[model samples]
Target: MKLTDLDYARQLDREDPLRDFRQRFHIPTNAAGEPVLYLCGNSLGLQPRGVTDALQAELEKWARLGVDGHFAEPNPWYSYHEIFNEPMASVVGARPEEVVVMNSLTTNLHLLMVSFYRPTPQRYKILIEGGAFPSDLYAVQSQARVHGFEPDDAIVELFPRQGEKTLRQEDIEAAIAREGDALALVLFGGVNYYTGQLFDMGAITEAGHRVGALVGFDLAHAAGNVPLKLHQWGPDFAAWCSYKYLNSGPGGVAGVFVHERHLGRADIPRFEGWWGTDPSTRFEMGPRFQPQAGAGAWQLSNAPVLPMAALKASLELFCEAGMQALHQKSARLTGYLHELVTSIGAGAFEVITPAEPEARGCQLSILASGDGELLHQRLMEADVICDYRRPNVIRVAPTPLYNTFEEVWRFWKILEESVS
Candidate 1:
């Protein structure tokens, strides 16, 4: 049977090992109470069914124990963030000591930059993708300014060659080499948010170190969406938000990774806070700053228990599903979507995201030939939920956790009709 046949899609879903995982999420519905065809996990994932219970448990603890909840039994509020260490480390491929759940994505980026993006008068440049997410660009520009360097001069952006939709690996490596001694920090998105291009992070990290620069990643679009080996890749730092592919609630607590080599070092200049102090010395209220041993040393405030509770729920799901199995299913899901979209023909849309699975995650950015927003509106009206970027791109991610082949087939039907 052809891929376009509805039964064929259904058959694939029936055979999928991860199909049962779909019921674990709270699928959003339409006016008729039918589940919407959701293909936007790259932006915001569906809420896990367990989130309600996870949050209520914390709320009850707050009410029952009040101030004592901080040290109370059964997931004490004080050390709540510590629970994420092993699970989150497994998601991003790092040691527990190297990972910490902390401030929001951009906030963690700025904090990590304080210790990693140290710029000298001679080597003060920062390199990033040309169309990086706005928040990352803003943070890097502001950092350049604070260090007494002009943003235009200090910031170097890598763009794809003319007519190309994504940057070539060689071009990225060459750019890092060209910067040579002048490069201070090489920060790039683990996956580009707009084009859905996954950069060669390991190669990028190696090149940055060769030039005597620190390297880091803004993994907002990557953490739970892709299989990452942060410890093996060995970037100086990395940060990611939990709300997207992780299926945590909106504005959820973010995560950070600091290479173990950088932890427990006194020479590194970090923005100190009470929470970053050693737990033994923390209650002592000492005047001196005695830093924590690992990534927790970057924390400026105590754990946000409410948001962390939500994150804990999602991370538990990830641990249960296993990243390896999730990734395998993601490739098949996105691959099927790609095949369906390509069949719609070049007259309607062109996929800007890389064709290779290794070079991307679950997202496929369709460069529409006509009004992209109008197409987006049509999809919304049909109860097909996806996101449209400015200009001509419509990004759809067939996430493995909840989305299925049948949904991909239905989305193509709607997209084909809308384009015609």
Candidate 2:
């Protein structure tokens, strides 16, 4: 495991079970015409090789069949969304009936909140993580305001204990206990976008439910990077976008999960549309709205075929590789990145992400002690592509599907020279 061991790195790559997956993606090359070391999958995953053909087929269908393409084409636009159900369900650890592919991430978050965040006068408080993504904070705050409550009074943010970089299970449990009586909902990210901390979803859900609060998760950072069990964990709802680790292209169709227990609750309120109505009775033009049985009940419109087509292409690759195999490779690749970065001696840089493998996905956030941005710029100049968060924190993710162990080593070698 020595940092200088090139043979060791190559050996690891040779033994990688998912090594063949790298060829399936189109890695970007630098201006000098060399393939840049890509470690930014946590932001936007590299495109799959099959996406071009998947999209081309749709365009061909449009040209040939015109309006009749809805039911005449091979994949058939009328039922194209249905083709994604099984693969998506397997990815998120849910039954087919409990998941749906739909609108963008924030839109789905708003729709889920409309149903799950039913704050009563006595139980009107919401709990969220302190360093959540800004969009999530805004959405939750807006939901509280529309219900005639002050954001500060109704939303409780749980932060890490003093001197700690991440939230602890005991601290989270204590907060739920203190606010459980008044807490109507508990919503948090499955993985912290900044620090790359993967929260304990099952335990948190249990703690929230103990106090009669509904639990939900924003799985943007965790969806394809980690193994999840949304159905078994019994979260009331969860949402994620497909652009990042899912590699479906930017602004692709997102996904949502709802537990089967909520399917029969006709009284649960939601913002519905024609697509969510019962299919058989939908075209009848009935005055009364009867929602579909499961997660489809949350849909707001007809499926957008282009984004869904790209998503389907990426998902087929995921289905072939399998999540468990991908995660197994991911753990070692990220661990190697962590070890190399930390071995570069103190006063040069520090890693803010958790050391425990179980507590993170693929990302590793490093806080350079001085001139962090300068070091990041140097890495970019060397054609090692990783993202830098403002002020501090350089985020590098060795995604199992496309990144190689040698790429991880080279990124750190560049960092060592830049700091020196």
- Top of the candidates by lDDT: 1
- After superposition, the stretches of candidate 2 with alpha carbons farther than 4 Å from their true spots are 1-3
CA lDDT, every prediction?
Answer: 0.94, 0.90
Each prediction's TM-score against the native?
Answer: 0.99, 0.98
Candidate 1 residue 281 Cα shift, in angstroms, is 2.3
lDDT of 1 by residue, 1-420 (tens): 988999999999999989999999999999999999999898888899999999999999889889999999899988999999999999999999999999899999999999998899999999999999999999999999999999999999999999998999999999999999999999999999999999999999999999899999999999999999999999999999989999888898999999999999999999999999898779999989999999999998999999899889988889998999999999998999999989986788889999999999999999888899999999999999999899889999999999999999999999999999
C-alpha lDDT of residue 112 in model 2: 94
Model 2 poorest 10 in a row by lDDT: 1-10
Clashes of 2: 0
> Candidate 2 overall Cα lDDT vs. reference?
0.90
Q: After superposition, how far is residue 305 of candidate 1 from its true place, in Å?
A: 0.2
Clashing pairs in 1: none
